[model samples]
Target chain A: MMNQTKFEELCASFALGALDDNEKQELLRELEESRPEQLETLKSYMDTAEHLPAGVEQTDPPEHIRAAIFKEIGAAPATEQQQDEATPPRQIAPPAWIRAAAVFLAAVCLVLLYFTLNLNSERIELAETVEQQRFEILDLRDRVQVAERYLEIIGSRNTYLVSMDGLEPSPSGFGRVFYDPESRAAILQVANLPASPPDKDYQLWVIREGTPVSAGLFSLDVDDQKRYFVLEDFFEEDFEGVDAVAITLEPEGGVPQPTGDMFLLGSPS
Target chain B: MFILFALLKKLTGDAQEEAELLIAVAGKDQQALGRLYDLYKRLLFSLCVSILKDRHEAEELLQEIFVQVWQKAAAYNPEKGTAYTWLVSLTRNRAIDRIRSKSWKNQQITDSDPDNKILELIPTEGSNPLHVTVAKQRSTMIQQFLNKIPDEQRSVLTAAYFEGFSQSEIADQTGLPLGTVKSRMRQGLLKLKEMLSGKEDQI
Candidate 1:
């Protein structure tokens, strides 16, 4: 029994989602008897209510929601028209040979891709193997040269053998140096030495009158057979100026002066 | 500007289009339904999210709303209101029902909103890209209108509209008498109607 203005007011709240449930039911009952003008007013109020949330950020539903909605209603999407037009019923099925050709092409492509991939990996592995063998060959040639040099230094008439004994740092370590004063070439042969830490290398230092000069660095890894290290450009000074040859664990590359614990020291026998 | 004009023209004709679209939907014209969805998805979705405050729940409710629209498209009476009004009513009722019945407020959008296989919603109008722009425009107008309303009245309307509070609940929340809440709500809504009327005439 609501008056026209009261009913309209309640309809406005109803549109705004503020109407009580009981009052909503009452509104509906009034709705059945409303004239067109009244309903039009109600509609405008509802539309106004709809717009009231300009403050609430408007968000588009996820696109998948569109697909989901179409799926739920069993309706084709708007894009279906073009898709339908593009695909005629009669042309839906391509020629059987075309299908076979497509399948064959796909299979051929897959096989080619598989073989190409396999061949590419094999080529890389082969290159790596060749590279490894090239390095090994270079290393073998260098070893042969060192052995020849060691022999030449050992057999030289002016060659002198210096017996080296282990220091406190490596009591069990011992080594020998053969120097040919004429060629100023030297070779070191050592054994029973602890492995070098990754950050440290064994450096050979030649000390003369308390002034030590760096000989060179050598790594001790693998078997004892390849223990000989040829000292390149052995010394800038004459052999007579050399007082002693000592090996120490220095930084990766040898330093001009010995700063680490001496592992071995050698002088004239 | 041209796009805005096109949308306005489209919205102007929306009364008939919406009715026709619903009729087609009743006849199970899915394309028609899709057209309708394209038109109002943003507006209705914004309303749903505004009420539900949970995007997931809003999305689920949007699906249910569309499904309900499909099932009841035939029952739609154009004489009662525009198609927009009908869609809004459905969205509002369902969202409010969820917030109230499921204790959506108390339950924490744990969103135990059971995965009911609900049907979809949307419209059968043709492509209209400006629907989003149109929603934004209408929202801007509403904001201006609300700002123009007195603070007390605007507050009551906002609480009632967004919070879905009843007059008595609003009275309690605002610490105002029930009679005062009712008066504020009526006056605010009357102002809204009047403002909208002036806008439509301008258009």
Candidate 2:
């Protein structure tokens, strides 16, 4: 007889389905003659071994695999036929009152269907209206934010406003630059500028000492009803010396250097 | 005592339902076969994929196993084991057999490294919440138990149970001695049984 330790070892392997043929036979013999407690222990081991796959994610086989399998086994059509045979036959020749009731129900169904179709169209229209209103609200919120910042800059005691004279590109154009020394915040508002060319943009540059730093690039909507194009977030960095602010018409995506004609220039007084 | 009785009743009820289905399947009731296929397909498919590491082959084997279930339902003996255990064992055995075949061996060589392959095949999407919760809880409990065992022993146990690797095969794959693999598997199972028995005592 195998020792208890060796027998348990074989049982564990047997539970794991890892024992070879010889060891399997030996384990089978032991299991056949084992006491109840020993059998329970082996069963527990098998139970735990079975649960090892519980950690693995459960995946459904492809939906058609079931159908394919049924087809292969010639069971799909047979099941359908069995189901049909098992179903009771439909009733025919209803009474007069029942026919009248059926006609009334059909009329009610038609009315409900008509209302449902109408309600669906109305709901779609309502959804479109809501979406449009949401976009309008968002646009209004953005404009209000810009107006609030503009008012703050104009109202600040420390802010200095500099006016720019129209230059060669557009003599009728005018611009204003607002700077707050304390907050180092600036905003630019330009008016009456000619519409930029399709391939060109209006670039703002701030001269700090001698070298000019590019502020940003923008293009105006000539067709817009608003007269002033307010450029928020004009300059992020603080420049110490008070100098000139200039606008140049350059190719789309402003050049590193001012490679185009200056459209507006203003030097702080 | 009532709770114990209720639990036993539920288990027996489920087994009875399965037994009836199998009987119908044995009598060539195609609908009963389909019903049986739907009932166990997910669990069996997951087990097959974990061993085979290929969804296509796992699905093919799944169909073949169900066909066998249809043909061999009459051979099932309720006195020997529960229907769930019998079905799971049949799937695992067939999957292991397929992996041991010559063509499968050659395919394994051309495939990616076994270590990089997903050892546990969990679905990433669209699983039922209740099923997911239950699976998670069971998996977490199993992981906690596995954590108690030593690393080498745990690896051998996992290779044998999840990958269906035999003791000698685990030794070959891990480059460990066959005796070491055997000892580790035995120690791992003992530790798991002890832990589970402790839990049962608490309950």
Candidate 3:
């Protein structure tokens, strides 16, 4: 069986996409033998990977797409206008008050029903407004917590920051790795790196004894340039023997070692 | 056929209703399917177009998605993931499959520009606030979060995410060893999980 550390590493790959057949079998085995907490952690990673697409550019699909979907589902197209206002009830509850002489009163009931429908629609609108507010509150709370953790990490005395400078491929590229050996909390911030192609990724490496060990893989921020990434407990070991840190372009997910051009490299003073 | 109006008439007033809607659809309630479609069509379509980079293909894929949703709705468990995640994840997987297919490459000449930078995205208007809020805030938070992650981490995450590269594929494409690819994937995803886990996606 792989150790806990390796299992966690596999969780990341599992969250990203398909795994090689061997790795997939191993992961499936681990999942079967793992505890609930381990499963929860794995779930969290999957959730994060799934949510990552929220940042992509949003475009409205053409109207016919809706018609097409409905048809594919063996249904009529639900037009935008058809959904703008609630459709009249397919069958209003039997007009119980109706009698030959009570026609007028029944009409009154009909009008009352219309008003009630409108009121119900308004209620839905209000409910949506309330939901939006709740989301905002949750959002604010999340941001605050993230900020607090960030401050705590930065304030820790054990934390040290190292600077990496651009190399020939990206002379303007630069990066910083802030790590706290005690808490294993780490953050990486970088900018000005050339973008990787679709099938490639940037891999970070830690060099000790003139050999590079994989740090991680990353990409240039597609929307905004600066990237600030944090890991809760990233360090598997103290960097007592580490000599330098560097970044290189590699295959999409990343390689076990650096085989690409170095874009950024740094050494601790 | 799911009647949109009838579906609205059946609202349970639960604050976050996507899960409930999905459940209802699993029972073959046409109305629930209609409601779900109205709620997510735009967002899903946008994601589809972004990946396939062609509206025609995106739309075709999208139609197939809903059909699949109707057929496979029973397999979705709210406990496993949120309705939003389930839908988006499903769409992403399907879209990726299409883009990576041999047929797609055979007919395609243009490629996604490697040099192109993704611009800030604003969701198109008209989504119900209840449906739109979390996704909207998530969008903003995601953009902000993306800005804070390291470039190397972002690249690999994006490659797996947008380009749908498997770890082995990534290693093969970049000439890196499989072990390094796994490390990067692990590192990038762990940090992202930290960011997303702070708030429970309360419906």
Candidate 4:
């Protein structure tokens, strides 16, 4: 056991983080068992020493540093709504059993339908119907898997969700982007968007430090105003310095840059 | 003097804001983390740069510190000290860790010497008004307190605190006896404690 005199001798150095590893461990051990009065004295010294760095003038780092940090952390810059939510442990994994059960039930129903249709129809028609049903089941299974993947990404701690609002002339529309930098995955969900002409498409852009890079062009099926687009590899490189996300109306194939008017814009708060 | 008082009042107000940001950070609010980063990045970066003497390394370390803050904000206890104290301690400790690491020693001289590098971390344009005011007040108070100590004693404290020098390191740097360096450091801290506590009582 160290004596009180030796403990007192090390207080200032300890506060400065200048002690060697062994001395630091010893001081911490002593501190854990020290009396209230002794603890208070030590704390006072630490409190004063901590203020020494305030002597340095405040300096602002380069603006890009903030964006770089946000990218590295795999979190979308916080938005006002997110700030209001202030939820702890924002990522919640959905129950795996629930998804598995739904997939199993769908497959069973499709198999039963194939057999029942065969019993009620002409052989040739029944065979065609069964083939179509099989294809539909496969499609449905693929869609479910995609939906589950979306849920997993959104439910992840690493995913950052940014809500985008429609610009002028499209005030009723809104969208959200869920991006996970680590996985290089992103999903774009748009609601109430005005139906686009067959020749035109909605293009998504990931704006990095004010330079907009085309994510891809997307088109809604059958004039539906809502759609969810998923990009398995949203960014070819690790998404760094991304400041904002925007959507613009463009030709069926997206241009190298945003040439048309923007319909939605969002920045990480 | 009037400006100083006004600045001090602003500093007090900003402390309350900082507390709220920390709470939000503890709740895992990324915006709050961003706000906290905006509030202290310069000061932390300046301290890192001063010790490491490499701008690129300092910026990298600054990002690492904030990442730690994002991960470990819950570990901060308000009762122990102010948010500023916690932030300064975290920055200094990380910078010191980098300085003492063997890899850093091998890479040292290729970068500039820390002793001669004047801190140019502060941006002259586009500074936040409240941030500027509070920083000015805190800097003024620390300088005033430091001025009260003897020059040699102050030098020892700076070497140990900012430069992360151990007593023997400070002795070698200053060409003084190791015993003299330790005594001066202890004396300087005691005087600073007295002065700061007296100020707190007045407040």
Candidate 5:
């Protein structure tokens, strides 16, 4: 036991935060060893010395302080403006919806004409079958090319690879991917996806073995950005034999086995 | 010493959070810098006022502090001291430098309020007011802790805290032996800490 009086004096000094570093340490050490009462006493003082009563609000910060903070945030580097100037002007000749409707009408007319011609050419069935098979092959080839380009992007250091395949609702719309592997940790992007319902959202999953693990949930913001939904993290090698990457429209937090329709799937190639 | 170590650990832990914020500021996230400013503004402002004694000069010094904080956030090393200690030291140094600068000779201190010198900050008056309130509360606690010390000892502490003076400088100003001033200052702080601890338990 050290002198209680001296210890109390030290505690007072400590609460005021006046002691030098070494002196503070020594006093606290002595208080800890010899006097449990002083230790408890000092704890109270420090605690009270750190608390504040309620209703002590700052009425207002000077408006100029607020302005300076905003100005600093908005002062983008001049290089950003230069970069914006380098882009070519966009041509806005016709509305996109009107152009889409015109294309749809033209397609309808072409399909009707094909059906009439096919009805007349009943004797040439073999040639028609061969042509149909050739067209199917061409479509498959295009899909592979698209998938390859997506893989190239995924391999970049900036993106994490996420795989999702069909599970429940709309099982056939399989094999969608999401990636966001950059320092910015940006928003998710989806690729090779089909249209989803207005009330539903497309959730990305990192499947491990037989389980559907949610990487993140995302929806398309614009038509131009396409099916690419930026996701959180990639499915590392731990997800071996992941049955298929699946997307389920769950009530936000996503589900274990995918409660909603499995909109898409991508098996390891 | 053990208790002091624990106390330092608690305070410094908070500093680490600020250091992380500083890192965010270096990335030019103005909001993070604003949060940092909000965290330390009161103590920093008080410290400036304590030395400069002019609100306007202190306000200008506050702007200079942030500018330096922005420019040098990358250089701060957590290993040197807690973020709070580092920041307070920085603010003190800047205020001392401002006082000593050639500009001080040209401008005379007037009776007019310095609130007019407040800098224009960001426009969005943020959502989290609680953080600033908590910091202010903590400063009040620290102030109360200072009040418990004897007047003679309190004067020495006030000089050290406000003017950023060394022990020898304090001794020279007060006409006391350097050793006597140092010991009294040391003893005064120890006693204040004890009183604060006892007062805290009563609550």
Candidate 6:
């Protein structure tokens, strides 16, 4: 039973992520009951953490990430075109046939140029130049697409869905983990789990016997279908434990090692 | 004497004008982009290093971020934030994304084999420092402030700031819970902000 000031102090702890689960739940409950002022302050404070590293500014994004974004964009135009077909054509848009004609003309010109320029040359040199130019065009087109899509993905920061296969127990069982490393958070979306008794909850372990750490307690939804569990704690080093990792039915919060019946197992490998 | 004073003011005005000019280049002007690169490369590189923690990765990320600015200049909304703020966010997000990715994480721990040659090829921090306007003295002050935090907090803060972890990631690495990690980071930052603000007063 913490008071308002204590709860506020704990909010600072919550914002810093220093609070344990019980403490965290308590603070969250308090936040729910308390005035909006505390919540606002907490949100602003947390948001600032995102920008506090402002003293350091990246001069640029990696060429690879840019390339990946471009690739995503480049692949999207066809999808966009299909979607656009369902609607009435806009007045400002270029006619599809005209655009197609232009593309055909460009291709013809490219073929002619290819033949004329390579008339006296060996096949290899001519092929290399054309391939290089083709890649360059492809890359440029991809970049244009990324520019269009950037705004849409901007709000969905720091979330990733990674699929993993079961390493043992039910090796066939597959699952996805929605991870946000920025928040040091992950949510397991287990497709299936072995049935366990009421006395035991499925304890999630990061894996590796001595190194295996407790992630948290979890159970499948009423359908015994998908289970969602929050990542409790982990280390970059704990990734070694990732292989052949198994979930087992245990008491709450999970035991240090696998003590009960194996429920689900997964390996990133 | 009056003319000299006015001339100095005008020169200062030109610096602001110069920044605007660079921003425009970043928008659609290639030469302007080159000039902006000339002006800010070193500072940006250092910032990237401070966060990316890997020189090669930072270098690559830096190039990509700039190209993005060039392509997306039309999308740049001046009202939302400064170019500097936008660029910082862009770079940080990419770096953090890389750091947290399973591929990158696996590479970091497993690829213990040192790239001695690559390490040598990469510019040492001070050796080829960018010629940006970030005063060495101010940078030193900031560095000192960084030193004041406990090593554990500093590690997590550095990881979060540069590598782009949410509160949860910090907790994961430090064996703390999501809530605790967020609180620690907020408290840590509040302290640094106060300290830096106080330092400004003293100055």
Q: What is the per-residue lDDT of model 4 for residues B1-203, given as tens digits with 9 covering 90 to 100? A: 57657755776677766766777788887777877886787778888887888888988999888888887789776544457766876788788779878443353322243211211111223222233222534666777888889999898888888888877777777799866776777788889877865664232
How would you encode candidate 3's per-residue C-alpha lDDT over A1-269 as one tens digit per residue?
67877887777877776465567667766766767667666655665666666667666767777787777778877676565343334123345554444887788899999999999999999999999999999988877876676677778887877799999998888998887788887788789886678899888887887988887777874633777677656657777777898989998999887888998899865
> Across residues A1-269, which tens digit of lDDT does each residue of candidate 4 receive?
56655666577776665565565556666765667666655655566676676665556677667777787778876543454465333323346897799899999999999997876677778789999999999989888977987887787787878789988858777999888777778888998777877888889998987788988888875543787777888887655567888999999887999988888998864
What level of docking quality does candidate 6 show? incorrect
* Candidate 1: stretches off by over 4 Å: A1-17, A21-50, A53-55, A75-269, B1-10, B102-136, B201-203
TM-score, per-candidate, Cα-based = 0.46, 0.49, 0.50, 0.46, 0.38, 0.37
Q: Residue A206 in model 6: shift from native, Å?
A: 99
- Lowest-scoring 10 consecutive residues by lDDT in candidate 3 chain A? A84-93
TM-score of 3: 0.50
Clash count (model 3, backbone only):
25
Query: How does the DockQ of candidate 1 come out?
Result: 0.18
User: 2 or 5, which is superior by DockQ?
Assistant: 2
Q: For every candidate, what is the interface RMSD in angstroms?
A: 8.0, 9.4, 9.1, 9.6, 12.8, 14.7
Q: Give the Cα lDDT of each candidate.
A: 0.71, 0.71, 0.71, 0.72, 0.54, 0.53
DockQ for every prediction shown: 0.18, 0.21, 0.21, 0.18, 0.04, 0.04
lDDT of 2 by residue, A179-201 (tens): 77656567688887877888999
Candidate 2 lDDT tens digits, B72-155 = 889776555556767877787788778777343343312243211211121223311111111223555666787878998988
Question: On a 0 to 100 scale, what is the lDDT of residue A15 in model 4?
Answer: 63
In model 6, which runs have C-alpha deviations exceeding 4 angstroms?
A1-269, B1-23, B102-137, B201-203
Ranked by TM-score, the better of candidates 1 and 6 is 1
- Residue-level lDDT of model 6, residues B24-49, one tens digit each, is 75455544454445444555667667
Which candidate leads in TM-score? 3
lDDT (tens digit, per residue) of candidate 3 on B65-97: 888888889987765446776788778878887
Candidate 6 local Cα displacement, residue A14, angstroms: 12
Can you tell me the CAPRI class of model 2? Answer: incorrect
